[model samples]
Target: MPKTISFNDNWTFTKTDSPAYSRQTIVQGQPVTLPHTWNDSDGQGGAEAYYRGACWYQKVLTINAEDLSKRIYLEIGAAGNMGEVYINGQLAAESRCGYAMFRAALTPHLKQGDNLLAIKVDNSYNNEVYPLGADFTFYGGLYREVKLLVMDDIHFDVMDNSRDGVYLTQASSGEGVFRLDVRGRLVNEAAASANGRVLVQLKDHEGAVVWEDSQELAVADAAEFELSGSICNPVLWDGIEQPYLYTAEIRAIVQEQIVDTRQIEIGFRTVELTADQGVILNGKPIKINGVCRHQDFGGIGNAITKAHMELDMELIREVGANSIRLAHYQHDDYFYSLCDRYGLLVWAEIPYISFPSTLDPDSRNAFEQLELLIKQAYNHSSIYCWGVQNEITIAVETENTYRIIKELVAEARRLDPSRFVAQANINGVADDSIINTFTDLVGYNLYYGWYYGEIKDLGERLDDFHRTRPDKPVLVSEYGVDTNPNYHSYTPQVQDYTEEYQLLFHHNALETFKARPYVLGGYVWNMFDFGSANRKEGGEVGKNLKGLVTIDRSLKKDAFYLCKAYWSKSPFVHLAGRRFVNRHEQLNDLVVISNLQHIRVYLNGELLTEIKDGQPLNVIKAVRLILGDNHISVEGIDEQGERYTDEIMLRHVLESDSSYIYVKEEKTEHVVNWFERFDLSAPGQIEVKEGYYSIYDTIEQLYRNEAAKAVFLKYFAHVTDNPFFEVTQGVMSIEKMSQLVFYGIPPELLPVINRELNRIAK
Candidate 1:
């Protein structure tokens, strides 16, 4: 049985005082666990402001040094930016890279007696080492898995450590001749040269012999080795569709005794990736319908759980997407494993975000991380591409970084030929010809009307990209913005600035894709609102609300289901609400549409019409101009030819006139509070609310006018200038909510007041 150990326990700690290392103070704060980090608490500004310098952590562990008599090694999952290990005050090993795993042998240091382990966690910024350009806070301390393993005299020796993580290389198909290359580094911290014979033992289930080997290596010098073998009765591993895993154990032995051991799951399947074909698995064309994800959620920050990741994947799968891009940096191992089991395609990347202009060092880091990513994740075949960077060229707005990225792309392809190499850019505008020379595929993070205004201009942007670089495959990597669902009131008129407008925006986007052959795929700007301490919605209080789902993952706006409808082929007939047949009579009846492909609209099981072209966008029909709870079904088509359908309840209202207007008054109490108290949050919410409300046909105009007016209210209150939406906001001329202070109204009714502004401005 595989031995299980825990790195979570009691430890003594002290803070280093001076560079001389003479003054040190011991303090008790809290307990820590392996596979952990001081990510959240440190650098919190107030009480937990992050401190620099040396902090030591010590722990007493019970070891079977006598009975086991085998080689005992101390394994550290990860440390902060950098760390040094000391067993019984004797320096054991030193390491860097806050993200990878490292281990050190402790048997030689053991004097057949009780020992103490101390680790110095150094998180000070170092411009020379990796993870330097990363934007987020570099929390100090040990923040990964830690363990102590006692193995047989001659166990399996470790071979490689990749950024993707430590794992055996995986190939497609198990029946063919397979080579198992076990790689690792053996560090000998000794005065004299220590010679040890490394014996590689390959064992299978039922204790069957598959392959084995041995090599003479000197421990004083860290040496590398690769073991090869073939399995006759091979077991293949695949994803959910054909789930199967074969286990292989490779052990390093010395003098007929095991010393180190490692296990791997073998999966047989080739990932055929190329520019023209995209990603192909098992000889079939596959599209990576994925999302660029951030390793964060509402409250959890980066310490998200498997449950959290699963929920996001579940949502992605529910929307018929089968791939994901682990944007900007490497994530926890659990996420990649989840992809393997769930059959979601992955594009893992490094943390070379937009930074300083000079990037020669980035090249070296990229090369190192590339090796780490490929070597560690070589076993799992879910990864499709290695995303280089997102809009760094513009974020830094430099030429040198562009050249560095260009060379790195070529290097990535040379390192990992099987997987595709991608770069998330800010649209192929500036470095047009240069981009195609480097990347296998180009992903453009585009925000047409939202950021630059003129949503209609997206076509021209796409046209220019195709005209400039026609050979490269294109993708709309990121789009969408913060949207809120609670606010109500909308009209389905063109340019009306309501939920209808948001619907039109996406509808236009979807239509745009249908016309463009250069576009392969597109993912929204974000999946959900995440936490960024510095971002107050830009002078506002809430976090990133751009997700189709809310920050807490609780609320999913109508935009979520609406976008789902565009991509969903399933049958869906929704009765939004009743329309105005007559105003005074107050008829609670409306029209319903099918959100799926040709689903014959049936009223009481009578065929109303055959929904053909508008299957996705238009799925409903007029039914007594309806209201209240109603039974509906999205007809599901299975092999049996039995159709299925989905139903929903909506309270539709009737409109009396083509043009309607209303104005409400507020008291002086509401005015003083406006200046006396400023909620930067209110301004930020205006855009998100508009983005969500823009689901209606005329939502943008409403947003351009009402939401813009509200934001201006707050900005004009203090700054007198707001760069929030320079281009987009200019489309509408409006003042800030301070007008409310002058008019004397309730601050709570800002939504209503904003809506009235939408009516008056139009």
Candidate 2:
């Protein structure tokens, strides 16, 4: 039998890249454990100051004399961006795909005593990598587990993309019969040829054998074999209702002596995607109530543990979400296992996101990463869609971009024909773009209410897409707004960063998704706030606040309960606006969210109103309150006569609280009427003098001139410190500054900026 040992302790790590340091050199660094990162602190701090470079980690592995004769291998669960492994000062193996697992044989490099092992991991900006640019922070380190596998001379191949070497394909052949195809590879390192029998068994969840088969294997160095079987009336692995699973155990026996064995948990199910209907799982239609998740935690960067993953799954389950979209890249294998047990449909994607590199090597890297992602996660039954790209055309769309995406879609289908391929197009991508039609399913990251248009326009925009492509299955892959719990408002509006506006946005969005069944379903932008080093919005730096739960997992925003009311089956009532305690108006609207149909409201110990057949969101308008503090409570009873209650206290005030508002630092008094004096219609009025910079010039052109750069940065830096300016500098024209009024840039400042730039000669 094979022995797997954890190799995660007593490693020395340093953020600096010591080129001279090797196995013979002593490393001067702090001792650390596996699943660690250098960006835990700096990555969460604002201002794009996080460290993104090469780091060094070294560990000493002592091999016993008795174990030196066996086949020894070292496995790295994951290394960010890229990594290289060295044994005894010699390069052994390298992995270009940052988020995939890989292993290297250590038998040739190991001795009978201590052996020096070192790894160099880099997360720096590389055009050849898949995620050249994205919104989330890329933390650098050996952020996953490491293991040592000791096996006999003849064993299952562990070098096939770091897989289990056993591939099982399950399908429904007919009305009560299912077929299974098993493919496996083995490696024989003995001095002479070996003959063995490979036994394969299918066992139910109760550990009872349902089917078995054996195959003869004879090999010198490497060999491959296949086996086929069938089962009668196998239980189907349904959605959240009942997720049944079976186990496949494979063993290698030499002369009736078991040498090596591998076990894998498997599930049998069918998924169908249609143009009019949503996801059909196990011959039933199901809406995908999903939330997108980033594998990071507050103050932890990307060095999360199994406990952290479990907590995230608990929160997702609490919100009554039936699915999850593991955004941007491949996640931990343990997380996939959790999804399998919990029965959450998943949207697994690669990190070919945001901007596409024109380099051909980058395209090849994308293909290789997709292959590793599919092969490693092929056994998980929770994954229904393989997302190829997300917002890939946001920077610039070209012929190469279209070709790369088409090839990725084709490769994903070719690798695993059992699942469908999907892509998340940017909101601006036209309905007629060929990129949208490249994948089997299509999704759009629409933010109508939060970014550009009114909240009500979401439904209209979705309708337009459905009308244009009635034959395509469509979904909203991402939708959300940044919200801060410290801010509150009675008149909620877009970009306010208030808890009330966030609630209103999701309320309207949920209603919109429910009204249209042709539109598959939507996944919330994020389940928790995550680190974005370039962001300085919502009165916070280095974070995107578009999450139902806070990053620390301490507080659940009011929008969370609103979702729970609609999706969760638990009979409960929640009084909304508990965080917004102070109000200036004497008469205010009291809101309550509950799953129960009947709800009773009380104000200051008096009966305020009783609502029958109440919806998920109940609003009692124009309820009079006392001059000082008033108590509000809501109650609901389930069918079992168990009462659930929620209460809060609100204080009525005559004046507004300035602390509750987010005030921009720039003064707006002097620029109140500056827009009236400027003209935009007449092109001849604002002349672009020869050898001078003007609004007609691109931002890149202005930044090239020392005098023009200073003038442009003085005003624009007050609104956002996002590095997106650098991304769009060469492409976006300075005239687009007028459209930044939505982002808190004053409309009047555009002419002033152009005027100052025009004064400086080119």
Q: Which candidate ranks first by lDDT, i.e. highest? A: 2
Q: Deviation in angstroms for 420 in model 1?
A: 3.4
The true-versus-predicted C-alpha distance at residue 68 of model 1, in Å, is 10
lDDT minimum window of 10 residues, candidate 2:
675-684
- Report the lDDT of model 2 for residue 328: 88
Which TM-score value belongs to model 2?
0.91
For model 1, residues 13-106, the per-residue Cα lDDT tens digits are 5565332221122345345544344545443222354465566777765555463465666766556667787776667777655555566667
Global lDDT of each candidate: 0.54, 0.84
Write down the TM-score of every candidate. 0.67, 0.91
Q: Could you tell me which residue pairs clash in candidate 2? A: none
Model 1 Cα shift for residue 198 (angstroms):
8.4
- Candidate 2 wrongly placed segments (more than 4 Å): 24-26, 46-48, 667-722, 725-762
lDDT of 2 by residue, 1-762 (tens): 789999999998887687654565445788999999887777777444688898888898888988888898989988997999888988888888888898989898888888889899999877678687778888888998999999999898888884787788888888878888888888898989888988999999889999999999896898898999998888877867777888999998887888889888777888888878888887888777889999989998888999999999999999998889999899999999889888899999999887665445248888888999998998888898899999887756667778889889889999888889999988878887888789988999988888888989999988999888998999899988998888889898888899999889999889998888887888998899988886778888888899999988999999999988888897889998988888889999999999997788999999899987759998999999898899999889877788999999999989988778877566475344434444544333445678889876766777788888777666554433446655555444556545433344444455666777778986
Q: How big is the RMSD of model 1?
A: 12.3
